[model samples]
Target chain A: MKKLINLQPSKPVRVLLGLLPFIILLLLYIGASDARLADNPNDKLLPSLNSFVEAIDRMAFTADKRSGGYLFWQDSYSSLKRLFTGVGISAALALSLGVLMGAIPFFRAKLSPLVTAISLIPPMAILPILFIIFGLGEFSKVVLIVIGIAPFITRDVLQRVQEIPSEQIIKAQTLGANTWQIILRVILPQIMPRLLAAVRLSLGAAWLFLIAAEAIAATDGLGYRIFLVRRYLSMDVILPYVAWITLLAFIIDYLIRLASAKLYPWFHSQEN
Target chain B: MSYLNIQNLWKEYGDQIVLEQINNKVEKGDFVTIVGASGCGKTTFLKMLLGTETPSRGQILLDGQPIASEPNEERGIVFQRYSVFPHMTVLENVMLSRELESSPILGRLFGKQKKQAAEDAKQMIELVGLSHALNKYPHELSGGMQQRLALAQSLIKKPRILLLDEPFGALDPGIRTDMHQLVLKLWKEHQLTIFMITHDIKEGFFLGTRLWVFDKDRFDPQAPNAYGAKITYDLPVGDIDKETYQQIDQSLTPSEPEIAEAS
Candidate 1:
């Protein structure tokens, strides 16, 4: 018999091992909820699985009394819109600034220090200032998310661009490429996959900033709904909303990874 | 006038001199292979020829005119690594050289121009014997295949001078021999003037029409940077005998005192 350290699991065993934790957690939650509910029949802390299902149905299937739209979908749509817009703007800004700073010494000297300084400042610290200036609206929420992630994404992009071997740039020049030509043809295509990767890494931080802003001031959003229901100790709604957010984040992250693998096969292969 | 001329060329970084009092002249079809110990400024010399590095003093003249301080289409280079763009497939990599030349602003060719560029690139790829792997990325290629792709990438530009810096140093011996035949064929067929730097003395002798040894005539143990390397010996390749080859090999084989003093 092999020692424990030397033992290797087969494919099916590995899959079972991965699922074990989630299954255990689910059973524990169900057992705890049953005990709590049997004791008082009005336990808000660990609502029964049935309560969670009913809460989800009410939020998702039923139309809101005040608003004509379904509350759950409306919140998700608004939150996703802000998230994508903020991240999209951040990605575009980072790519352009990064390529310039990385490739050209002039831009690097002038802007690199400033970018570094900006990245060092805590983005959350400026949330109040953003709300004050841009006001308590969709714009401020978007700006907060942008401020939270853009500098980080920009720095990643700049480092990646700098990481491009100088030989490739010189070879491009020998092919009669001028400055613009080299950036467009040689540098830009290579930096793109890196940009996608940077964006994916920043998505967690992006969502954090977006939700925090929404909770603070938005009329309708996933974060807004969760925070609003907390007044009455509405764990049923809050728990379901948290799960939905986690699922959304996971799906987005998975899609980005899949897209990167398909679109930039060379980049992934090089990583291996 | 010679096709290329170097008149008392010097390169220095700060107070440290890398190459000093280098002078050479080459005809259009000369294949000059440079061999030197490490840190002897062989690569700096090649970069100077490629126009990516400017001489700190003096000038390099091409066709009786001063060479551009920046790299241009007249010269092409292949490094030991990062010679080909990793993002592009082999076909796209070769096509890009022509595309950049044809369309300056967008760095892209379209319709008839694109089709013509692809056709030319395919021919060049075939010349390098990479026709089967046209759509493969650089990461998919073996070292020798990558070098072949690099060759195709550079050759498509029709450079008058091809600069190679230890292009086969990392390849297996069997692959290196295959690459040698491919390169010689390309050199003859294209009628290109080539400057290749290699650490291997035998490779220099085997590949070049002329072999150059870069070594410092003077060395300062105290300052170390007081004197720089120069073209100590320039021999026509076929005229050299076996004894001379052994002497050159021993001199460049990294003796402790020489390596320490040079660095």
Candidate 2:
């Protein structure tokens, strides 16, 4: 008899095993939803599958009478725009500042403490101040996301840069590389994959900051729409919106991971 | 003047002395192997020679000029690990020094220069017996192959001085023997001045034209840091008997019962 810990599954069995929990959850949800609808056809607490499809159609397919635009698509566009912009700026800042701080002792001594202190602050605590200063505009929302994640990414990148063996740096010096040359050739390529990884880790926090900012200040966005529909007790609409947001986040995470693995096979190999 | 001169060199970190009162002159093509117990400042001595760690006192002169305070193209080093850039393929690893030197700001070469550098790097890779792995990254190469790649990376620069810090300390015995032959062939072919530090006394004897033993002649029971190591034995390596080898080996081994038991 094989021991449980030592037992291994074949490829098809592994795939089926991965899907087991989701399948169980789906069946359970369908049974509860059917029972609730039988008891009260108008029950919004556990809406039927038909109700979900109807809500999605109303939000996505129907054009708003006031603005002549699809609310779902518009909200998605605004949210994604803010998310990418904030994360992009943060990535750029992390690459430059992090590499400088990690590679040069002078910069490290000067900036590392400041970065550590900044990263320690709760970003949400400063949301009110950001609203006061930037006046609840898109800029403030974007700035909120940047301030939320930039310090963390910068610190992560700094650690990765510091983790690079000193021998590589010394070897570069002996190869006649000046400081600028070393940064460009030796440090930048190595730091880039690490930067991607940092960004991926920070995406969850980035999204949280984005939704919070949008909920507090924005007239249009995924978070705004969800909050707007809350007053009507629109569980059908809210559930789908939440699922859509989760799906989007999953796709973005997947894409970033795929890009990293594709571009830096060497890094992935070292990791394994 | 000697090809290289170390005059009254001393390296200290605060009050703790690492290396003290080191003085020697090395010819252009001399292969000097150094052996010492762990933490006896053998690496510190090598770092000083490579111009990474400056001596607290005295000076080192190469061909009648003081060696630069920082590492330069005139000196190359291969550490036990991380001697090759992980991100680069074998060819790129060997060609990087040339690219950085020629282009300076961009750290890249183009057109005619790029072609010439690739050619030179390929030849160097061939010399190190890594031609088949030209496109392979450091992670993909075996330990011995990676060290070979590291050698190619350093030798591509054609440095005046080559420093090896326990370059084969982590290899299998069979691979180490193969590497020893490769290093000897490269040394003669390049006519290079080399300084190698090893934990293995046998390796020191087999590879070096001259061997240096770093040990302190004085010890204080109250304060261990009161003294530092110096070149206690500098011998020309012509023929060494088994008894002499055993004596040096016994002397270098630490007198700790725990270490002996662990080994």
Candidate 3:
């Protein structure tokens, strides 16, 4: 432990070290793409940088000749809307239900086992059921994301709420708080950033559910586009789409982190 | 009948009685400090006063009426730890009850009332000597400062009874002494009925208008639950004379109070 502690360098150098892996991956990918293109100019497996750039330009800059709509922006907007909506509904349900389970005995007894059971069931297993019930449309996709991720978020929020000292609740009670007041006044604000964190953790599952739902059945979405072009083995479009999704996810995650740190710094430090 | 009365209060878990045949009355503005050996149910007694726990037998009456079953604004509590909310600033912690009790939706009072609550909370923070720290979080404050914030939060509620469990036990000796003086001042200024449980004998005696030593009456080797602790000694500090001390010394123990001031 002492050796590990002593090995730490200053912040800037450490941050640079953290980026080395990404740089190495990029260099390796460029070399592989260059070698594959040299062997065959029309290789779909590892398309050249020119292919990627042309793919981006066509999807982003030029409107599809038939659809006459910018596919990249349209797909981005639809996917982002679904992601936030699913995560938003999940966060709301998780916060309310989690606090109820954590702070109240009746709720804890009633919902704890049920939530645990629901979370244990594979979300993908229920995907067909959701499509059948909600139909193969946007609602089904959003519901899939919620069902896939809400339980985990709910469980995480419940655990965090339980970690709060009982004394804090009792203090609120002594301050004229009834059950609702205790939930709203005492528990809600304290758990806000923590719920954000729970959402952040559930993001991976959220994205998985979203992509699966979209890939299987959707009219217009990033996941749908990737799957749509798979028949032709369009690695160019697929790779760029995957990179775009990664960039969007990274941006959203970074924003949530920044908001949590700025708005509720106490919860941020409490994380450590 | 006094402002607060515990009449024949007995508390027990299935087979073991913690307190039995307890009778005490606390008057308004009384700073009552209780001392007892560990596991003697001193904290339980204070909890009963807060209505967080109820006795198996008998009842606690406030102003001739039985106290409510659940905790309310009438009674406030401060534990040594977790007394202050970690999320709120000191002033916000003090203002929370005011804000919460006002409106359910926004927790906001209209123009003047909001200003009024802010002003009152500010004054309360100053009263606890935390004016410099109204904007700081609980973790940023020292142990003593956190306690001061806790005290301020409770005092802002203007509770009829203040229950403290080892409030100063975590503070340094110097801070503890300062806290002692602050408590006395608050008690006088607010006319609060304070019931404090302390492990330290000296602190119990030094800060209280009335001091109670709690321990069991009869300890049976085989059947300990048969009897539980009562108020072995209830002394009104600063009132007992030399003769009373000699009388207490002559007795087998101070448990037999020669005199007790009626609450």
Which 10-residue window in model 3 chain A sums to the lowest lDDT? A1-10
All candidates: CA RMSD in angstroms?
Answer: 1.8, 2.1, 5.3
lDDT tens per residue, model 2, B1-263: 99999999998998898889999999999999999989889999998888888999999999999999888889999999999999999999999998998897799999999999999999999999999989999999999999999898888888999999999999999999999999999999999999999999989999979999998778665566788899988888878777877877876987454354569
Candidate 3: stretches off by over 4 Å: A1-5, A270-272, B239-263
Model 3, residue B242: what's the lDDT?
A: 71
What DockQ, on C-alphas, does every prediction get?
A: 0.87, 0.88, 0.59
lDDT tens string, model 3, A1-272? Answer: 57885787889999999999999998998899899888988889988778889999999999999999999999999998999999999998888899889989999999999999999989899999998898997888888888888999899889988888988888888887778877776788888998988888889889898988899988889998999999999998999999989998899899999999999987777667
**Cα error, candidate 1, residue B131 (Å):** 1.1
Which regions of candidate 2 are displaced past 4 Å? B241-246, B255-263
Q: Candidate 3 DockQ category?
A: medium
* Candidate 3 vs. true structure, TM-score: 0.92
* TM-score of candidate 1 relative to the true fold: 0.96
* Higher-ranked by DockQ: 1 or 3: 1
Q: List, residue by residue over A1-272, the lDDT tens digit for candidate 1.
A: 98999999999999999999999999999999999899989889999989888988999999888876899999999999999999999999999999999999999999999999998889889999998999998999998888889999999999998999999999998888899998998899888888998999999999999889988999999999999999989999998899999999999989988998999889898898
Pairs of residues clashing in candidate 2: none
Summing lDDT over every window of 10 consecutive residues in candidate 2 chain B, give the lowest-scoring window: B253-262
True contacts kept of each: 0.93, 0.97, 0.73
